[model samples]
Target: MADALITLEAVSKRFGTVEAVRASSFSIADGEFFTMLGPSGCGKTTTLRMIAGFELPSGGRILLRGEDVTEVPPNRRPVNMVFQHYALFPHMSVLDNVAFGLKLKKVPKQERRRRALEMLEVVALDGLEQRKPQQLSGGQQQRVALARALINNPAALLLDEPLGALDVKLRRALQLELKRVQSETGTTFVYVTHDQEEALAMSDRIAVMNHGVVDQIGTPREIYEHPTTPFVADFVGSLNALEVVIDEVVGDSVVCRFGEVGRVVAPAPHGASSGSTWRIAVRPERVTIGTEQVAFDGGSRLSGTLQQVVYLGMLTQYHVDTPAGRVVSHRMNDEAGLSLETGAEVHVGWAADHTSVLGPASS
Candidate 1:
């Protein structure tokens, strides 16, 4: 897009014998909250570092606000970063820590303090500016880190797992807080994390990465509901898989014979061939289980033995053994006023449209 605030064009990075990032190309639109998400060693952090100018790309270019910044040093780029560890100086008070970057750039003493205090207020740390890092709690230190980064008022802010250090409750709180701050500033944010829920919760769009390459890039809803690949389907949420033998291709739909589960119809995945073996995938929440036969609106249904039942406060999850092997089904605690029990004979079903046919699993 023309309004992209940051563009990475065919960028690749190598370290000695290993390639840390492949030919990656993506654009973060102006004032958008974009995230890079993947498991460890998936090149998410390397991609962020290249954009930050901490690590140079071996090929292609990096552009910021329509200007080529591939050759620019870290300090020269119009960007600031909040590190995973906060990277706050323990010896310095919050004010000094936030003002350090401005001072390094030769900002005037009085102006730096003014900007620092303003950002501290922006991050809700106005009164605690004189406290050292050790004197503050984990969440407080994170806010200070954010204050320091935002004090520069850069075109974009880069966060590398910024909430990874806090406890679960605090991390959740900061996630929302960070989102609010980003909206209030209207500054583009490029966040990196391995947590799928965090990405889905906070990102306007997410680039799912694997094996040093971007596997898919889309809105959180697109990545979740219509995953383009098996990796994306497996990575983005809980999945249930069924092995099936493809019978034929009927237009854009594929007819498949699921083992011990009978025939099912699913939309053929792009590039799939007729009569080829495939794996059918469905999300756990998409499956419905009941002691009686349930109407199939658009999904395939089958009978399974309830092997285990786990009762969470909001929902009940059942581990079912079916002809297609083990399947996990989740039902809302109040859905149909039904309560599932172990050893129950239940029929499981889902809309056919929810089914995804994938490449046959490797033996």
Candidate 2:
């Protein structure tokens, strides 16, 4: 926190009857790839706009490197924003587009051109400096926009769904390129996106927002492996959520009543008590296929009827209807899995460590 380059202290933004962003407080470290990730209308883009000084918070403060800039105008803030549109001048050459901000600053023409060319090389657009925005590919134009933003040398770069306009393959390619450029430049990046995979792939830390509030913030691995809330568990990846009642606590685990799932073992989280109800979450990859007579190694097991099997080359997804509930299992598509099909009776088991237990889902 001491090294945070940007900090939001109880920031709130409202428009008439609706609050677009609640009192969100978080910090992005110096040279960190921090992301605000959520679904559409979750205020992620609004938060980015606020950081870039495009939206003024109705309450609280916005800090940049320990200085309060809560009331700073967009032009005065030490930040720049790149949007999905890439907003390049249609008639200007690529170099001029990248150097437009410098020209406005009255920076010497030669120096501005040098910096613009350097940034273009950084973004792998060296050969297209003379081309117009319409002359280059979508990805190239995006790189030009990134070059334009970075050339200003802002304290932080705010990106609002910058890859949203590109096709899937181009988006994926540019995600890596952006990551590489960030690493090379060591500039603080606060990116906004609704795509979970994009956030997980690019961010050093991610703040997961929902309904105008941050549900959780953590590294991708931490969020995926140890989600503390049901929304985070369900949003960050595909997983099964089951309603169960705690039967008892044994050693370091809890025995849960899964109705027809029989007695099941789950990791005992704090605040859990015997006879209490909870939501059980497990990833499809964590559930293993087992036989009726086979005993699993310290985990929950259930019997089910295979309802569907989808073979996706690398992995196979099995939809099973168990007495307790329907669950999905993901297994590597190896030679042995070739025989699996719908209508077959199967046993599924998941390790307690791989399970996440949360409060009951809201009504």
Candidate 3:
């Protein structure tokens, strides 16, 4: 955090009786693509608004490049925001729309137009500068908005689900475009989105928020592979949670029993104790299913009956009914086990390192 660009120290926000954000703390590094990701009502948008000076925090402070800006107005702060709705003026051409900010600052007409055209090239919209907002496609309009924001040369760019309005295919494409623009401009991006995939694909680091709390922050791989909380594990990706009772602890591993099937040895989690029951979570893609028993060194295994096979274009999903409960496994469509029929007996296995011991199972 040596070159921290934006810092939130114990930030909290309230809307009358409801607490929207609570004691959230984190920092965005200079020129980094930092994302705030979570489901609706998770207070991510509120946090972004607070940083953009649109909403004030009820407690704590916000810093921009080491200077406290908790009370600064949006126009006075060195930041700009892009909304899901691109908010372009219908009467203006793309070039005019992009140069509007500069016009407001009384920048020379020629200079603003030159900078605006340069930004259009940066966003890959140089050829469409003369088109009105309504004449362009959704993605093109989005780039115009981006160019408009970047034309001002803000220290940080705040985006609140700017791709939320695009179709899945277009959204996926824009995720990369946004990352590229941020990289080329070297402008710090604090993007807010509820889409886990978008956050995972476009972010340098992500802060997963839940019910007003910033649960965890890490790289996409770290967050997906080693989630620190049950909410983080469940919300970020597909997880299969199995309730198991701890039988014993041996060094760095723990023996646990699930249902009447068998025991499993998993890497010992912090605070694990014998006889206590907890839910162990594993991502669907990490679990493998096979008709014949396959030994997985340093892993857990279970026997189950194949309940269903779902064919998704790029991958296949196998649902198996086990003694403990139902578990699902995902594999590429070309994987060998896709031929397994429903009702066939199958073995489910995953490495102990893939298992995450969550909070104690409900009574």
C-alpha lDDT of all candidate models, in order: 0.87, 0.88, 0.91
Q: Report the number of clashing residue pairs per model.
A: 5, 0, 0
Clashing pairs in 1: 298-351, 298-352, 299-350, 299-351, 299-352
Question: What's the best-to-worst order under TM-score?
Answer: 3, 2, 1
What is the lDDT for 282 in model 3?
Answer: 87
Predicted structure with the largest TM-score when compared to the true one: 3
Candidate 1 residues 1-363, lDDT tens each? 899999999999999989989999999999999999999999999999999999999998999988999989998899988898988899999999999989998999999999999888888889998899999999999999998888878999999999998899999999999999999999899999999999999999999999999999999988887777789999999888777666777788877655555456678776667656677788889887788875785447677789998989998889998776788998888786687788988888778788876567567
Candidate 2 Cα outliers beyond 4 Å, as residue runs: 257-263, 292-296, 335-338, 361-363
- Tell me the lDDT of candidate 1: 0.87
Worst 10 residues of 2 by lDDT: 289-298
My TM-score estimates for the predictions, one after another, are 0.92, 0.95, 0.96
Candidate 2 per-residue lDDT, tens place, 166-242, comes to 89999999999999999999999999998999999999999999988998999998888878888899899899888
User: Which pairs, if any, clash in model 2?
Assistant: none
Q: Residues 252-356, candidate 3, lDDT per residue (tens digit)?
A: 988876656455767787788998878878899998888776478868888889999999999989999887678899999877535889999998988888888
Best by lDDT: 3
